[model samples]
Target chain A: MNLLQKFCTRINLTKSSKGYNVSVIALLIILLLIGIFLSISIGSSKISLADIVSAIRLKDQGSNNYRIISFVRIPRTIAAVLVGCALAVSGAILQSVLNNSLASPNVIGVNSGAGLFFILTAAFFPVNIYLSTIAAFIGAILAVFLVYFIARKTGASRMAIVLSGVAVSSFIGAITDTVLTLKPDTMIARAAFLIGGFSGITMDKLSFAGVFILIALIASLVLSYDMNVLALGDESAKSLGLNISRIRFSSLILAAILAGSAISFAGHIGFVGLIVPHVARFIVGHDNRLVIPVSALMGSIFTLLCDLLARVLFAPYEIPVGIIMSFLGGPFFIYLLVKGRRGQLYD
Target chain B: MIKLEDISSGYNKITIIKDINISFNQGTITSIIGKNGCGKTTLLRTASNLLKPFSGKISVADKPITDYSDKELARKVSFLPQLRSVPNITVYNLVMHGRYPYLGFSRTPQKHDKEIVDRAIEEMNLASYVNKNIQELSGGQRQKVYIAMVLAQNSDIIFLDEPTTYLDINHQLEILQIVKRLKQMGKTIIMVLHDLSNALSYSDNICLMEKGQIAIYDSPEGVYKSGKIEEIFNVCSQQLAVADGTKQYVFYIE
Candidate 1:
């Protein structure tokens, strides 16, 4: 009896450590469903869950409320979800490739590069949204390339990469501010884009962004094992039969594409890319395969919730989704920083 | 069986190791020993295909190493480079990474693969700390975990570059014991060792190199008795006989 008790105790401990992962995933999914429903129902009209469902099924006879729900709100909700997932997955990949706790699209200057190009396109050319998006994508890629080329001496050093990214990002940001100051009308337009809101997203734009996001997401998932090996350092990874250069290049490219697309559509939504991945890592441990997918899901949920709060908090005068995310993500990030400094996550 | 035929290898525009011709026998432990800057590590890296040789060719079982696909080469040979910094990971998962070539795109380990990893962990006597993060382990324990990872590769030939740099005397011998056991299991083991005594005692063959050239490559007794240790290592030794009738070389300090 005693032997059986001891055996069961050992089994229980092992199961508990493993089971925490499933529970966290389950909780996040539940939160996501709740956030989705609340987001659809909590607009200016304040429709009930039944009306939202009926509207979704196209079985309701109503005023323009049904059209508002189907065409406008639905597209915005999906844009929020897609943008959030894209940004979060980009953050997770960048952090792993840089092997630093602070690496993200915002910190590394990729977002700033996209923003600068976005403003330039808006000012110089006719603001065809597609052209602006393409310009942003090119700018993001160029920025990452410049940072990588400058920082890499013999091989990629994490500190060098991060520091170089900061320097280049700040330089680009300074130019952007100078340009914005020169043209106040351009600044107003750019400011609306920069602060980040889902108020005006259309189904066509959402579908376009969705395709690119899906490609990036699939690419990230496929290369997740390589990402795990990369975290062990280049020499070790090479010895373990990984082509270090190929892995690094592919991960960086994927991160750039995802992040650039999100910035193009939503401007620079700051915290979703930076915080969502860290939260996922904390919950799921450091396995990239699990971290990538879970972070995507969590990011989508986080963005949806933030957008819902953005609509309801100041009712009639909507706040930017980015502001709400910062309000929520800022405190959470500080807690992670403290926890990391205390070495709580190292083990 | 591993053969390096007159290989010249180095970094870009700088030759580190030149004209190295040697063959490591199967089912034996071979040690490469040399003074600092003699290109011991460069030779190991070249032989393991980590560095591209500027000239000459290396073959495993008569097939050129460069001809093999990455996965194919991994299946035949495993390497453990000199330790720099330990990443944050657990011992169990670290060992499981060794089976990556076999698992391919599926990152999850199968039951049999887990059994092999568990056996490797047990062999290293790291069962108590199997669940603990690798960064928290002592230097010696961490070294064992790394060796266990290479062992979990289940390859016929293994190469290690300076496997005992940070270990004390006891852990050093413990690592040597593990290498000897690997030799007994009919695996071809080649390593660069800094400690002359450990190299002589544990290795079946010794290759002493100086100035990017082979000083001597022979049996331990042959190399020690050939009076070349004095030229290669700048030291003299006295032959000592133990009660077990095993001959040991004791180096005499000036």
Candidate 2:
């Protein structure tokens, strides 16, 4: 066989192999360990790796340093990892459902919808983080339904759905800007949160969002095969006995839940959803069973690295996680676009 | 066996098919041929339960099609629409999806399911391209992969709309042969064919449609002798004799 033939065959064999799952799990574990270490070491204090491990083990040499590492840095790190995983899995699911390369929550307006609701809750309720999270979740769901309804009339064209999402998101964003502009007292605080950061996260809020992300992640993994089947298109899926409407609706809801929960806590971080899944799919192949979990791990690692940079690169007066991610993810996205245009990645 | 009784189906308020009645028997090949906009694809879609009928009933194996759960209906009936763009997927995975009705939450293909998929692939002579991505193959080869997928469903009844679209002459014959082979295996196959000679040669029964209703549904000889072809297709044609009692139509362009 030619080299291309051999490569294609090897990919096909790996996709069908049982050992595929084992290898992915192993990679995920390694990434998790690396992410944990990076999250602990990269902060204002510049703790040593040994000190960080000792602090995690509760065998600290001093109280002040231990408290800083355990209470402050650990929660932020946990929040970053969970939110990263959530966004990545959500992106994978959205791409599969819409069958488009550019169907991430940020691009398709799911995040914008949630962000608008979050802004509303912040403006009106002022002090209820939990209520804001719920409001965001509800808003995300409503936006998805609106997009579905508008696009359904056009026979559910992927391009039409994406365009509708963009239109609706911009409209909602304009409304959010109007509200923020009018409420001068809350404007700066809301803008800071909107810029996306995990710096001020508490253990309670992290744990709260973590539970939702965990459940949604498990649900996404379980439905990964269905998502793969769906990529074959709705007609083929129906012939295979899949309830197309049910699967699409449930998977979209699951993705919205994960993304909405993440945005509620971490604000609207970009690129984790858009870039991580595409990169993970390139590494692991398009079998969602592997792609979903692998993307989650890759997302965690990418976000941890970006968050680390955000904290230490400017030292004290930290950069927003969103800005840092944009710096890294923007170039990666451009590379993907160029490769896709050349027909190297897609073919 | 599949039966459609006075079926009327279409998008919302615009009815495309009007009270159409048709029945297809087990272990036989049937073809529905009609002009553009005559509702052949719509009829097939409704019969396969992809589109719900505005009125009338479709029954599969003595039960209403709508009454059967999605999985239950899939095990009994399979439908392949007209060829469009094939995604970059392997032939093996495409065929394995045919066993999706039997898969549960675990989504693991059983040994028996794998065996069935392999047999279907072998039957289509796609073993060489089994591991090749579908988009890398020729149009005919891709069509065969999809046909193999439907066959792997192992349903008693199968429906295909314009299965020969985009295929070369040789591949068209290859596909017709595979459909014939499926019939020999006791499958009830219903397909839409644009070529009258192919429909007349391969199908045991032919349903010639005009506008939104069936002009005639009977044996090929019966429909040919009824002078309905010229009436329906607006083409002048004569049936020529072939060995083994099969006849071919020669169409004359005015």
User: Which is the leading candidate under DockQ?
Assistant: 2
The total of clashing pairs for model 1 equals 0
TM-score, B chain alone, candidates in order? 0.96, 0.97
- Candidate 2 docks with a DockQ of 0.69
Per-residue lDDT over B100-119 for candidate 1, one digit per residue giving the tens place of the 0 to 100 score: 87784656788889999999
Weakest ten-residue segment in model 2 chain A by summed lDDT? A338-347
Tens-digit lDDT string for candidate 2 (B1-254): 99999999888679998979889999999999989999889888999998889999899999998889989999999999885546656789889989999887799999999999999999999899887778778888888888899889999999999999888999999999999999999999999999898998899999998888999999998998898988788888888887877678887768
Checking candidate 2 for backbone clashes, the offending pairs are none
Q: Roughly what TM-score does model 2 have, to 2 decimal places?
A: 0.93
Give a tens-digit lDDT track for model 2, residues A144-221: 777767766776656677888888888888998898888766676567657888877888777767888899898888
Candidate topping TM-score = 2
Where in model 2 is the C-alpha error above 4 Å? A1-25, A59-62, A149-160, A337-344, B243-245
DockQ of each: 0.51, 0.69
TM-score of chain A considered alone, across all candidate predictions? 0.87, 0.86
